[model samples]
Target: MRQPGRQTRRPERRIPQSAAELARVHERALAEAAARSAARDSAAPDDPPFLQPRPEIGDSWERLRRLGLDPDAGAAAVHLGPAEIEHRRRASGLDPLLPILRGTLVEQGEQPPLILAIADADGHILWQEGERGLRRSADRIGFFTGARWVEERVGTNGIAAALRAQRPMQVHSAEHYLRSHHSWTCVAAPVHDPGTGRLIGAINLSGPAHSVRPYLLQLTATAAKLAETELRARRLESLHHLRTLAAPMLARVNGPALVVDAAGWTAAAAGLPPPARLRLPAEGWGSTAVHWLPSLGECAIEPLADGWLVRPVRPQDAVPAVPGGSDGPGADTAGPGAGLLAEQAEGARLRLDLHRAGSPELSVRGAAGSWSHALSPRHAELLLLLATERNGLSAAQLADALFGDPARTVTVRAELSRLRRYLGGLLAHRPYRFAESVLVTVAGPEDPYDLLPTSSAPAVRRLRAGLVGGTVRLPGTPPLPGPRPRPGRLPLPPP
Candidate 1:
């Protein structure tokens, strides 16, 4: 109440922080970050490269809080405005999973660290996944579901701590500077997409300090993997729809060039008819340098100075050879030429698609038409970069481009096993196996490294075309049929 002409002033909000609180926060940050760095180094040592920190983590957060920063309020004070909360929610991709994950925290199963709050990748709590009261209080203190939690913004918690460590972690009581969170222990692990291996989110278990042990970090890590795997399955199913429409335009392809060496044969030119070269029916015309497309049978094999090209021999001015279909100009069914064209187009498109698919997540194709791929997004990216380069990338080159830490080469190699499995599963097919490929290393073709998607499409096509087209020799005895109807008009007038 204003007394006459005097106005009342609102009390300023003071952060509750003891000296111990400050030290605990700083120590946890340095120690955890160092541990993660060491783990990364030990996991990758052959590469002698190094990296540096940005906007240094030291004192990044406490300094901001001390400055009374609240961008939404447009005032230098603590305020969790609606706009700010929404902003954080969107940035984190958290709104989709918040309710379900939060429900799990509250449900009567094995109670984990009560997730009082949860933030997205950017450290913003898109939704609180814990006790309502704790959630409300935390929200008031600016720890709602949708709010940033970068190390510099907020020090030491399941969210920031996990991101800082780049590993699963538990930041126990006293480790958090804000008095509001001192009663909690938060365990967090990053969640990634199995397909791309990108960090999508983090699942955190927050509860009373006594309930969560540091070793529980292992459990969170496993759970995070499961979550990621499930997401991968869903993503694959969705992407499959995009990849495999009902049209028979494409089929699962995998492997390297199927080679048939013609070292024993003589050479010829493309247009020039070599008197020594004999024309083989639809297929027999082929060379080691280049083979006839299996689909076009009995084609003339003409070898050019650069390579060999096979042209099909369709009978000149011949009628459509397709059975049980109209042979008119507007025939809608797949005629001989059309069938051959479809195959040609498919072959062309397959090469382009495989080449453009960017990342060869899986190198091997299996019989089942699926293949395995990398579990680490970083590795997948490295594989793509290596495949794209004129020369295959070395371990050091990959590490430097990916993490700016040349030491990550070992992790990259270790991760390839998982990538191989992923790739193998995705590209499963018979005759198109995805083992390590023997490609010409751009640096030195003889010094082959195995990160590329080596495909033997030509060889596979040869076998497939023969199997699909050659085996249609119907063996049953032929029976005479009833009188055929008149062309275009019925025989009613004659009857």
Candidate 2:
């Protein structure tokens, strides 16, 4: 109790200097925040600096609310199945760099360093290694290999911060927006494709809050750069190898000639203005095939040592007419325009109901009547992406949207091949688009947060954020059991 005329004093908030202290600070902050949220009336003052949210954390909090997430709730991180995890590791092209990163960490000592993790641009943790004890602790919070840590999924953290900032960042204690993550600290840096400068993934180090330091952030950033440099060097070496193999072939070809990897990356070119890029169909170049390229028109494709040799075909050349979904060379001339006409004549309709939280479906209607097609989660997202794009998307663009990295064109091609078997002629190539003649309609989510809740693709996440605004019902999750709250505040949804 204060004496007469004496003023009451508030205790000073302490800055955490150790892991235990950080945990204590988080508990205090949680209690204080809960008190503020529970107040019936009175305006809450700004949080003290030590407890105040960082700019990125503040933005992430708003995103979490818009995504219909409860501040009090915790959810396990999404992880890929074992098979899918292996596929992702190969597709990510980061396997080569993993050993280097691990070696650097191992040199730090036998005590074992903080968790060293690598996540694809979509924030999927492709590889995670470090101290075994800490790994077990992290598993409780879903920080294992294959787990996803995108901002929308996990709130503010070093990985998400690095991706957004396109640099290194350290997230410590209450600086993290999610209460569950307040006990740890993380530092991360974005990695990029050396050729295109596109974000590929991120390299991160995480552990107890006391382990965080300025130098760790710098070290992570340097490691990312080194890894990217290694990738660049490898790509250049491949191109050099391609040139050596193509010299004799280029000398023999009479017209425009170019060598491209399986995913259509240019290796060597001569006599042809290097066409932007050419993504071959799933059949690859083992057999003779025709690929309609962006700048080169229709071209006859042939396999090279480690790539393909493409020669633009003149209109006068009497090649077999391009056939729909055919493997023969004749299928080259069946252009997008003709494909669209065929689809229109058939009058196909595609209806997609993606509003259902975890379950999204697509149905196709033709002369024989409509039938629902079973869609794998990836294909479901692919169809949704194509449905949104009226003009269609190039292989690289689609890859970027689907995998959060454009280099995954190989994966995109394989998946689209399966989708083609399902849709048949309704799906057209050239740019991997829906046939213009098809009538496609999608039933969007009533609440933006519900929009593709299962999809963590970067493109989908961006669209979700763009569409979600103000307040929304908890559409991503099941409704609360009790009485409804006010318009803006929604109960936490189950994972």
Candidate 3:
């Protein structure tokens, strides 16, 4: 807890002081006032104070002079009153707005088409996914940052309509209500959590009507897909994080979890009540929460919002013992020859499982808590052989220990080379060397790694629950039927 005035370690960044100029451009107060004055009404409608032109602009030079601004320095800034200063503090950019607007649409050397930028309701970039030059343009337009695309504020542009309609739409060229935007076309699509019907956001592809392609509509969908894909992947990562952290806790409490990702898929899961998977239908699991099965052992799950949770199962639920090392049939019968190789086989199993899902990672550590980044089964064997023997294994001795056949001489040497390079890379500070034809182990009193990286403390629990022994139930579409099952073979359509 922070004391009332104490600073937190997560320091806040300083707000930029250039916001005054940006406010003047985006709000267009001067232009509106000019139009109002021209309309024969001396009194203008109330305008946001910050939106009024800065007195420091070209015409305001003399006024700036009174404020002690040095014209020669190019460092003189807009002088604002207290209220104006506070309002500017809340404005978006530190850059001059006109230059930003021009930079967004116009080209400069090495600065391409993505000059312009635009943002959505949640202050996120939506149309910025277009060509780089246009993106640059939008950026200068104040469309990229602190933009709110919610319906009432911006009307039916791609971002606003998607949220309001809760469906995808394309607000192409000439469709814009704001006459100022008659030059550009936009295509946008809404992303949904199919299970919950919650609209995450929309992706929009926009560019100059003359330069952009009609098929940017397809590009819009593609961008939405990419976003959804990323959401799903992040879910999986969160699940893995939960799995590792929840291990110690899950042992203490019994509970099942359903891990959801931003894209509606249940990315990773563990301790799901058996009855839920077996008794309930397959389609039953996607979006909503169901009643808990106390028989599975009641456990409370804490949700780590970016889609991860770890909780205990019901206390009454029975959890079978986890296998010590062996799994799969044919567990015995390795004979005296393979008796020492069991851990190597177990390590191999783990490696294969990892590769099938994603990356391959295997670790073997001594009781002293030292880790060896063992890749091949042979590597595990050599490490184990080194640890067990009272007498060190020489080049010839290791060859005998690894493969009894002396003809396998060069083969053992190759495996040793691999192991040496791997461990050396991982523990670079404390070097491991391969000298002569022999393998040597270096003992250095160094502490192993203690913490794993994660976003924050709250997310740690859910991330750990994801990785270990969890099943992910992904959304699926029914397969197309084969030509209506050959009309005659299936009964003819009933009238």
Top-scoring candidate (lDDT): 2
Residue lDDT tens for model 1, 262-314: 21111322222221111122123335333222222234444433223334453
* TM-score of candidate 3 against the unseen true structure: 0.32
Give the candidate order by descending TM-score: 2, 1, 3
> lDDT scores for all predictions?
0.38, 0.62, 0.34
- 10 residues in a row with least lDDT, candidate 3: 445-454
lDDT of 2 by residue, 203-236 (tens): 9999887555556766777787688778878877
What local lDDT does model 1 show for residue 165?
37
What is the lDDT for 488 in model 1?
A: 21
TM-score (C-alpha, index-matched) for candidate 1: 0.38
- In angstroms, how far off is 408's CA in candidate 2? 34
Number of clashing residue pairs in every model? 55, 5, 49
